[model samples]
Target: MIKVGITGQAGFMGNHLFNYLGTKSNDIELISYERDFFKNEKTLEAFVSSCDVIVHIAAMNRHEDPQVIYNTNVGLVNQLIDACEKTSSSPKIIFSSSTQEDQDNLYGKSKRDGRKALEKWAIESNGEVVSFIIPNVFGPFGKPFYNSVIATFCHQVVSGEEPNIHSDGTVNLIYVNELSAAFYSEIISNKNKSTIKMIPFTSTKKVSEILNLITSFKVDYIENGVVPNVSRDSFELNLFNTFTSFIPKKHFPKKYIKHEDDRGAFVEIMRALTSGQSSYSTTVPGITRGNHYHTRKIERFAVISGKASIKWRKINTDEVFEFILDGKEPAYVDMPIWFTHNITNIGDEELITLFWINEPYDQEDSDTYFEEV
Candidate 1:
């Protein structure tokens, strides 16, 4: 059982790391944490110092200006390195450097500097350090804003729009699952040696092929000469495959879910969310008929048609969070355990929700816990 600490635990890569850690059912103790150095360095360092393997992931991911990128990416990494140097007991540092070649762009520069910094720190501390220069990583639990080509492309396709490409560039893409596994393997499995392995891995497929495999959804393939020469099956299984046990399972009891919402209001809502458009109006209410909540159960909800507010409270906390269902939002919301939550039909006619859960309904673990209709 190895102790692990993950920084940048909230962004696309961070979320991927956390999701992977959450699914593990091993003696391994994983502590996933996120830090935006611009926000809180003290808390970030404290978190990094808490584990045996410190996975540093936070940095300025994408930008054009060299100074801007260096200041945000390289500069911040310097802070993390400094923190490690000062630590009474510095752990092995696993930095998520980019796979982009030695280019001059801000993104590339920062990643390069990060790699150097980690090497220097490891040498100074007489401790081991590993860096995985990952290529395009894409899959579930990934952020749509940055990281891989898949999220951006998937957003375009799902919104019924064409993606704009600067050039006909084919990237080496790996599923999120694969990248996560590689991370774990290098950090815990190979922590004994002070070696740097530049994995110019082979299992990379085109973005179009990846999009097809994950979902049945279709898209108009735009951008001439952009597709690569990789097979569909070639893109499966990587670091992320090991993290599948952490993912929540399907959870919708009974053979049926209520209300089909015939008018397609829910579909429009999903369109709006996916397109990154806010303030769209729903012509009808989504829930043509009911109010519901689960006891000791968790659920994930996605908007299908018109816009609506999902009001939910944590099981034993007064903290409440309201999310507006949209296509740009994640496909689902993770409901809390033993929480009282409900979706109101805020649209003009009817609203719709596409939801699922981690487990099936067991009478021993199921109930409305209330009898108010």
Candidate 2:
């Protein structure tokens, strides 16, 4: 279990990293700093002091002015280093830097400066800061343009537009999930300290080849400086793209069955709501069909397609409620927390329910209940 604190909680890359770390693979306690890394100095200090790892993914990587880059990227790293030094314990600081060989852009220079600061900090502390330099990570969550070549292509293709390639630059791009897995491998798996891990997309294929294979888009490969020579043979990426294409749409509001309530408990517990006797038939969906209850435990009626209302009530409340079991809009309906109820399908076909409850179900933690309503 690692106590990891993330600086840019809402930033695209940082968000992906946070989600990856939050998975079941490792026991991670995460606290998101919703403010800028430097602005929230006190919060960052407290977070770094308490945690074992401080992953600095908050930096201005793209800026027109060199001075702005230096101030934001390099200066931010320096502040973080100072905070680390002042902390009670020396937390391992891992910095995420970029890679661009040909251009001496503001982003590239700032990253270089940040790396130097990290090195200086490590030396000052006698090799205490464990750092990792990552290059060109592309994934599902990130927006296409910012530091991601593959995403740019994918974004263009998905939006019914053609991809724009600058000088056919062939840079190594690792999938976000793959990069995340690699980080876990380097950090938690590798116990050796006083290490600076640099995972460059050094051996990846040309951007031109990836475009040709994945889409029917036209690409003009630009012969650039020191770009990798490897041709794109991304079987994994292609296969995923193919599968995604066939789906034609994304699934929203993912569905799952609610089984938190036991059949026996629900049946017995629901008996208390019976202020008045109600007739219910078996052969319907069963006791487990309408197992979920709203947050306030409001009364509800399970309408049997052809049968009568099965009157039921909540235990302690003893609130009176009824159900319209037969028609599309069952009459005598007093559904809320008061009436815990279930209906049967007396007519042929699936029981078409025109169900209603007095109150909307409290979406969080209210659905799974054993009590009647």
Model 2: how far residue 67 lies from native, Å: 3.0
Give the alpha carbon lDDT tens digit for every residue of 119-228 in model 1. 88778788777777777666643445675556665555545556765555466766665677777677657537666666565565554554553333331112111112
List where candidate 1 sits over 4 angstroms from the true fold: 36-41, 200-202, 206-216, 219-373
Residue 239 in model 1: lDDT: 19
**Per-candidate TM vs. native?**
0.58, 0.58
Report the lDDT tens digits of candidate 2 across residue range 63-118.
Answer: 56667866787777887788888875566667777654225777677777777787
True lDDT of residue 243, candidate 1: 18
